[model samples]
Target chain A: MPTIFVYVDQFKGAALSASWETMGAAKKLAGEMGANVTALVFGHNVEGIAKESFAYGADSATLCDDPTLADFRAQPYAALLAKVCADGKPDVVLGPNTTRGRDLFGMAAALLGASAVADGIGLALKDGAVHVTRPAYAGKLLSTVVAKSRRPQMITLRPRAFPKPEAGAGASGSVTKVEPAMKEDDIATKVTGYSVEEGRVNLADARIIVSGGRGVGGPDGFAPVRELAATLGGAVGASRAAVDAGWIPYANQVGQTGRTVSPDLYVACGISGAIQHQAGMRTSKLIVAINKDAEAPIFKLARYGIVGDLFKILPALSAEFKKRLGK
Target chain B: MHVVACIKQTPDTAAKVEVKDGHVTWGDAALVVNPWDEYAVEEALRLKEKHEGKATAICMGPESAKEALKTCLAMGCDEAILISDPALKGSDSTATATVLAAAIRKMGDVDIAVFGKQAIDGDTGFTAVAVAATLGWNALTFLSKIESLDPAGKTIVVERSLEEGKQLCSSKLPAAISVVKDINEPRYPSFMGIRKAAKANVPVWSAADIGVEASQVGAAGSAVTWPEIYPLPAREGSVEILEGSPEEIAAKLADGLIAEKVI
Candidate 1:
């Protein structure tokens, strides 16, 4: 039977929740194709992650534990992954739609001479091929695609697209150790160091995001937006216009050119809701827009909208939220 | 040092994208250099200026894409090339990277290559890495700053902007980098630069010029095939504009959000 391999992505020795989600997806695909599901865990110490993968429904877990594999530097990592995938000759390979996955998967695909699909939301087996559905044109369109003639078809599943699988009744899967085919000398690039942004919630992981746009007016205008976010214990985001205008940093920008976020609740204050901006937050579970112009395009996607001056609405909302939350 | 910056012409962000009869139409939208690529061009020009080297703008698209290359020239690119062929349309990121890598190889002396983090269209953000893979070079993506460069040593250090923080990375020369907006400020075209760009002749190359097979250049070479595409359904509800004073509206909205437990 063909095998399906799930790349277990981790950061700082902690496995990402999306890894389990990918394993869950691979289980379904395995059921449909009668294939065995294997989780490939690589890091400095990934034995625990391998065990966890078994509970998440993998038939086997392959571990490539090495200090050199801790931080993801594409070349050596892709080389090792490509080598493992080649040896296993899996029919399908799955990874998370994340920074590491996006950076590594294509190189692996090229190395294996396989088809690579990005940002896949839906997957299925059809006529001996894995078909995928992905958003195109900035989420304004959905395209169903198939890697018709490729083996070890590669796909990066969007985070949260698949639900996590229930843990198995027992830790029942086998663990195998795979030696990396790459050596230190083969790495052309090195990560010298990292500087973490202290005291801020990552927008991608934030359950609620309070984002602003040109409607925030100027750099100082962000104070009120930050205030509301603080009151609600949510992250602060901005539109490209706001970032470009120097009102906020590009790190906070939420749009097609910026980060793609799918928060449980997204509140937009003063954003006009251009297609570029909408594309980033369209998948949010709930959307609310506050704009002075009732006819603003953002209102079209908003579950709730307040058509009034943001200068008045924002302060009032901040006061109300603070009072209600008692924070 | 020779630098090559890859650029693409995309519909303006304001355009409403529509699909009709399997073709994408963006009504009345002018094709311009991708907004993000402006930073790439700006960074390339900066590097060229600092090193006293030549920077060339390269693109793969229809004849109209030359306009985008001209804009690059106007922004101070020393020369430009347009890789155009009928067989090259609808190319996926991998195929696009293949053609671009071939073109860069044909250039023969590109010490560094620059690209935007991602184009507004397609938005795959993988071409730089794919190109680097094709060339067996390092790809330093999401770079926020070009911290240092050693031309003689053929090494460059860059600061990469990640979701949580910044990472300092170093790579050898002959590296492909995809830069973010924080790298530099893009300058507007000057009158002299505009005149020079307008009068300059841009050389156009076909698939054969790059030594790529027809089947490996366009849709035929793509790994993924789009079987169906349509606009996302419009949100079904009308905007229920709160009709009250600011305090009343705020109270009502807060109550509603709290009731829904989405606050």
Candidate 2:
């Protein structure tokens, strides 16, 4: 029987929530293709993550727990992943399009001499092959791509594109152990250290986002935006103009050149909404625009618009939300 | 040190790209070097200047791609090359990487190959690592800063910007690195440099010139196929502008969000 392999992306032992979402997508695809879903987990001391995959819908899993795989060096990880797919002969392989996911899958696909469809928003079985629907031209158009005859069709699912599966405590699956493909000495890249920024919600996974733009005036302008985001338990985003103006860090940028986000609620504060900025947040379920200029382009795409000063509007909105939600 | 900056020609970021009659088109929109590639070219030139090394720009596209190469040259690249072939049309990222790997090999002794984070059009962000895999080189992607470079020792250290945080990494030379927008600010081409680029001779290589067979390139070599192309469903823009005092407007908007169940 055909099998769909999903890579379980974990960092420091905890699997990313997107991995479960990918498993959900894989399960759906398996149902359509009459295939089994197998989770592939690789990391140091990641046996628990492997076992947890079962609760998220994996019928079986292959685990490679090695110290060398602790840090995500593409060389060893891709080599091992390529080897597993080669040995298992899975019909399809799916992974989340995170930073490491894209890096690993790209190199692994090259090693296997197969094509990988990255950032797929939709998938379906068509004519005995998996067709991936992905955004092109920075979300302006959607293209359905397929690996016509490549074995182990590789694809990376966009974060938040699929629903996360509910985990049941009693769910279980068969687990298999795999040996590391390469030793530490053989890898060329070395992870010297990591500096993590704590207490900030990741924009890619955030359900709600409040963004600021040039009209924020300066670095201090993000105070209200940040307050509203914190009140709503969401992430704060900035427009390219704001980032370019040094008002915020590049990590907070949202646009074609920055990060593409699809959140449930996207609130635009003091933003003119350039096309490039629209490219990033057009997929949001609900858009609210707030700007002093009624003529701002953002008003055209927003479901709700407030033509007033954001400084006053943002504070008022946050207070109202605080009272209503009893926060 | 010899650095090769790989670039592509894409529609301007402001272009309104649309799919008409099963084809993607950006009508009357100017095509320029991919926005991200400018950072790559800028970084390559900086590396060249710092190490007194040679920098070359290479691109894969039709005859019109020469304009993109010219932009790179005008941005201070030492020279430029365009890899073009009639048979290279409809190539996927893998096939394109294969040709690029072959081209890099044809150049020979290249110490580093630089690329942008990703092209705005395809947005795969896969070419740098794919090329590295093909050439058996270290792939350092999403690099925000090149901390140190030791040409004599053949080593490089860089800070990679990942989702979780910034990671400091070290690698041996002959590496392929893709830079993010935070790396450097791209400078506009100088008047003199623009004049030099207008007259620069960018040699175009074919599939056979790089010793890659026609079967190993273009549609025949691509594993992925685009079976369909279409626009996203149009978003309804029936915007309801809220009125009244700031407090009143906020209350009404909150109620609307609650009704929509998106908050």
Candidate 3:
């Protein structure tokens, strides 16, 4: 039977939720193809991580454990995965669409002579080919891609796109460790150090986001947007135009080139919908647009549109929200 | 130090890429450098201006691609090269990466290679990493910030953007990378830069010159082929113009949301 390979990713010790979710999708696809699912790990202590993969519906687990690969670098990590995939030869390779996963998958796909699909929201099986849905035209539309090749087909699934499955009734599946191909110089890049934006809600986990755009006018104008976000207990985002205008920090930008979000509620204030911005947030469950020009393209995609000045509407909405919450 | 920035000429972002009979087709072409690639050119020039090195902008596409390379020359690249040939049509990401790695090798000495993380049209996210692999060089991707470059140590550190957070890594020299929008603010093309780029000579190379076989150059050589493509269906939606009173429009919109099951 054809085998499916899923990367069991780790941040500290536990498997990242997205990795398991990817495995869940892999499980479904593999089951559809009458294929068995396998999991691959390449970090410190493979024993602990291997157990989680079986619980997620993987039938087998291969550990590429090495002291050198304790930390992930593109070259060594990619090389290790490539070596394993070369030997094991799974029919389809899957990974989370995280930055690291994207980098490693692209490199590994080239080495393996495979077709790789990016930003996969869900999988579809048709005519014995794997089709994936991804956004194009800046998120104005979704494109379905089918890899026309056979064997070693690959895709990076977006995190949280598919619902996560709970641990199965049975215990962890079988585990096996394979020696990885790694060397000191093989890891051309090394983790130097790291820092993150302080005290802000991680956008991925945020349920709501209130994003500002150039229509917000200036840096001072973001006050009401932030106020609305705070009243609603949401994180704040900005359009590239706003970030480029120096009205907000680049870290707050939301669009195709910026970040992909699945917030439950996303409120856009004073933003014209650019394709890039729309691509990032198009998947949000609920979208509200407040802009002076109701003709703004953003209003076309918005579930709720307030065709008035955001400067006027935002303050009023913020006040109403606060009053409702008795703040 | 020498930097090679790979630029691609593409239809403007606004142009719809129509795939007919399994080929990507665009409307009457208004050729421009791929939007993401402009950042690659801008970042290369900035690094050159700051650290004193040559930035060579190179591209592979139709003859029109020279215009994209010219922009690189305008931005202050010391040299420009275009790899264009009729035989090179429909080269997949793998073929393109191999050909580019071969060209970089022919350039003799290269310190770093830079590219925009992904092109808007294909969004493969493969070519940069593929080039790095074929040339046996290290690669770091999705770079947002370059904290510093220490050539003396033969290593530089950069911060890569993730969906939720950031990753900082230091890598050796002679590496290749693809940068995201967060890397650096790409400067506008100045008049003088435009003039220089327009006049700069861009020698065109073919498959044989790069030691790439015709069998490995275009669709004929591509491993993964496009079997089929259909115009994406228009989003299923209709506009309800809410006018007159706020209460009336709000209530009408609420009804519409309920009708559409969007609420």
Candidate 4:
């Protein structure tokens, strides 16, 4: 039977949620190929993550536990994972498409000489080949890549692309520690400090996003958009017009070159929608536009439009929302 | 302080490209040095200008990437070395990194390696770290500004950008750093710089010259495959479109939101 290796990362004993998403992908492939899915736990001291990996549909987890592996460095991690892959002979390997995953995937692929498809949004099995779909051209287009390679096909699945499996009832798996080929100098990069960005929930993962544009006038004009987002427990986003205006931070910008989001609700306030901006948020489930110019291009795609200044509309909506919420 | 900036002639950042038969054909699309790599080159020049060192631009791409190479030269790189091979078509990030590491090794005396955080196309943010891993160098990513470098002390200080704000870190020499867009405003090529870049000799390296087997340089060596390309999913912005007075539109939008349970 074939084997699949799913990498589930843990920081301070808690596994990243996206790694469970990878396990879901691995599980489906395991069903089709009759392969047993295994998770690899690195840098975790306790058995908490290993047992949870089994609960998430992994058959077994091979733990590479060494205090030296405590810090996350690509070199030692890659060398260690390569040793595991060589010994395990996984027919397929899955990882979350993230910063850490990107580094680990590249190093592992180079060392294992395996084909790696990255940031894939979905997977399709066709004619005995796994076809993975991913965004390119900065989310302007999607590319479906196939790995016509041998054993240990590697893929980094995109966030929120698939459903994470529900925890099984009383799930458990075997655990073993595999020795790795890591030298002391291999872990050269030091984690001097870490500063996690705390703000609006990651806009990429938010289901509701309220975005402003240059028409909002300037950075000072974004307070209403921020307020509206807060009212709905949503994230705040901005158009390229706003980002380039230096009105809002570039990280909040929604455009082809920026982060792509598929929120359930996308509200565009005081903005003329450009093609690039549309490309990023086009897949948003619902689009509401509030532009003073009735002829604005954004109105064309907006399901609902209010031809007025965002300053007027956002406050009205916020007040109305509060009223409805009995505030 | 010797500085080596690894650059690539990525498709113009603004160019929209498509994959056809496993090749990126930016037909009608302008080609330029990657936006981030240009920053990498400019940052290199800035460090050299301040610290009194030499910054050589090393590019790994096809011969045609000479345009990018020339631009790098015009931007004031001391030298240009091209790592191009026929077998390197469709090289994934890993293969690309491997080839780059070998090419840099061949081009010795490299204490520091700088790269654009990522090429715009793949946005994998992997190649710089991968090369660092293979070359046994420390990796720093998303750098906003290099505060200072003291080769004598073998240490460097820089602000590394995170999603919220930038963190300041000082790493040892011989490390790999990927700079972001805001690192420094990349200088426009002056006429004199353009002339110098145009007249500069860019030595091209084959796979053998770089000491990497041809099979291990391109698509053949890549483990991740680019097998499919497709148009993105179409979103039907509600056919339940509302055309009405401002009051009515707001009312309908509100009702629509309520109907959709979004409120």
Chain A TM-score values, per prediction: 0.92, 0.98, 0.86, 0.88
- Each model's DockQ score: 0.67, 0.83, 0.42, 0.44
Model 4 stretches astray by more than 4 angstroms: A10-13, A44-46, A64-71, A177-186, A197-200, A293-306, A323-327, B16-27, B157-159, B162-170, B237-251, B261-263
Lowest summed-lDDT stretch of 10 residues in model 3 chain A? A134-143
Q: Write candidate 2's Cα lDDT for B47-103 as tens digits.
A: 999999999999999999999999999989999999999989989999999999999
Worst 10 residues of 2 chain B by lDDT: B229-238
- For model 3 the TM-score comes to 0.89
Please write out the lDDT profile of model 4 over residues B1-263, one tens digit for every residue.
Answer: 67888887766645656667756677887788877688899998988888888888877777888889888888888887887888888887778888888877876778788998777677677788778867877777778778778888888877776543456666777888888666777899999999998888889888888889877768777656665666566556444545555445556677779898766
Residue pair clashes in candidate 2: none
| Best model number under TM-score | 2
Model 4 chain A: which ten-residue window has the lowest total lDDT?
Answer: A185-194
Candidate 4 residue A80 Cα shift, in angstroms, is 2.6
How well is each residue in A206-318 modelled by candidate 2, as lDDT tens digits?
99999999988999999999999998989999999999999999999999999999899999998999999998998888999999999999998899999999999999999
Q: Kindly report which residue stretches of model 3 are placed more than 4 angstroms away from their true locations once superposed.
A: A45-48, A65-67, A136-144, A167-171, A201-207, A227-234, A309-327, B16-29, B237-263
User: Of the pair 1 and 3, which is ahead by lDDT?
Assistant: 1
Instruction: Kindly report which residue pairs in candidate 1 clash with one another.
Output: none
Which 10 successive residues of model 1 chain A have the least lDDT summed?
A180-189
Q: Which lDDT value does model 3 have at A234?
A: 84
TM-score of chain B of each: 0.96, 0.98, 0.89, 0.91
Query: Candidate 2 or 4, higher DockQ?
Result: 2
